[model samples]
Target: MRSLLLALVFALVAPALPAAAGQTLTIAKARALPLGSVVTVGGTVTTPSGAFESSFFDKGFGLQDGTAGIYVSAADDVHATPGRRASVTGTLKDSFGLLILVPTDVSLGRQGLPVFPRWTTTAGVSESTEGRLVLVAGRVTKAPASDLPYGYKFWINDGTGEVQIFVNTQTGIDVSRYHLGQALLVTGFSGQFDTSYEVLPRSPHDILG
Candidate 1:
């Protein structure tokens, strides 16, 4: 809702580096992309999306291009706000089945526009919705709980199925204020831990009541 200007630097632009060989970089391409492929993708930062430097988790921010969203790990001091457009050139990585980008270079770009979340069900998220931003409309029927050293994990049942929502302490989210079984609309990047699928919210707005 605030004036969006949160796009970080574009890590794909380098005068010395050669252009993309054959990789067509885009969020949609990454969805079913082959492992180890090097490419460049650009998109807008969604709500709660920005640099999240933390010791426990990878430091970066969430990005979306209307088609989908994914996490981008940048160096410390790289700050981008929500709605900032960013482009990154890197290799695709599957960290225990969770996909991400290992960027090489970085540069800032024009601020991106705001992007609304894509409403999806728990089942939809569980099936094949990793590495993207989505909206889960459901109720926080229970108090938020911690998932050990990983992060603070919560539960929300959309009547379709139950799903885990993870938020790190450094993500700027205060889970203590949330009520149990309260109607909420959560926005976050879909991720996974081992075999279970989860959503990693960027900030408090990701778990709105």
Candidate 2:
């Protein structure tokens, strides 16, 4: 009887114990972290909203610390609840301003759901026009009223990569649903507007999922 009681007590107590700390590190671990290494870290996410949550930015965190905290955009559906705990995973790429972790995944811990900013207002368009293949996120500006009607054009700016996104109408994308400020992510051919280039959209969907 005593053996059974002890077994029951152990079973009850084991689960209550705190979870073993996973392989985790701080932003300072960037230099030592190897490429393609999966890691977990905790940090404070700054967001448009005033709230903050204990969050996890994973995988690429180690790579970005050397350069700077990863440059994440609100347009990439990566906005986390302010002060919320989260876990993220992605490839680490070094960029000019900050080390960038091209996040593959992000999860908010016990914190409630996050509220993302809506892409509203036409002034969100950015002026940076460099010829390079890249990803941009921003609000859609008004379509040109002029007669040049080959491809659909809209402006996207995510404070990092900003450009005019031209999607071929042949893809059957409905332009009417795109409001002035609807958040959008544009992944396609990127180059200087004056330079010879092409913009091919991966999909026609709302910026916020």
Candidate 3:
């Protein structure tokens, strides 16, 4: 009778226990999970905390490992600067067209070298490059416009194709200095807004004549 009673107690207690965390995945594999699915990923922080800001996401940082990269959103500044390795557990979310991880927990590992930006042309920025840092050079094909209330945008074209460059107000990057036909080297995270893919410069330092 006591053994049966203990069995019943064990069954009742088990239901209240929290579920185990999902297996750790590479950033690329985590990005493949269905939206809203919980997952854990390990990578090196590619952006300093609060370096990139947007209305569509919380203040956060970018993370990348050998496989791929992703953005991690947190309510508060995580202070996970570039080159710091971290393990993030979160639910997958689609912020506009950009894939992001809304972290429930973040564990920092040892500091290491940050992932370098891949050099590509305007035509090369696409879904496969999303969330990774990239460098692209082109002439201004479209001038600045206030498409987003918090930011300004312009388009650049290499001989190959065109890509948008979005400067968020938070970055204090002055787009007014650029004009049609100006040649520039731009570097930033590859991002998507709705159907459009863009390269977002983190600061004036990311832009060069």
Candidate 2, 149-191: lDDT as tens digits: 4555665544444455555443345555566766776543222
Residue 59's lDDT in candidate 2? 16
Candidate 1 lDDT over residue span 39-92, tens digit each: 788887653334234422555667767566666665544576777777777777
- Name the candidate, 1 or 2, with the larger lDDT value: 1
Lowest-sum lDDT 10-residue window in model 3: 14-23
Root-mean-square deviation (CA) per prediction: 12.4, 16.8, 7.5
Query: Higher TM-score: candidate 1 or 2?
Result: 1
Candidate 1: segments with Cα more than 4 A from true spot: 1-24, 47-56
Error of 3 at 71 (Å): 1.2
lDDT of 3 by residue, 58-101 (tens): 67888887788888987788788778999999999888888999
Where model 3 places Cα greater than 4 Å from the true spot, the runs are 1-22
Number of clashing pairs per prediction, in order: 12, 15, 0
Candidate number with the higher lDDT (1 or 3): 3
Highest lDDT: give the candidate number.
3
Which pairs of residues collide in model 3? none
lDDT of all the models against the reference? 0.68, 0.40, 0.85
Model 2: how far residue 206 lies from native, Å: 9.2
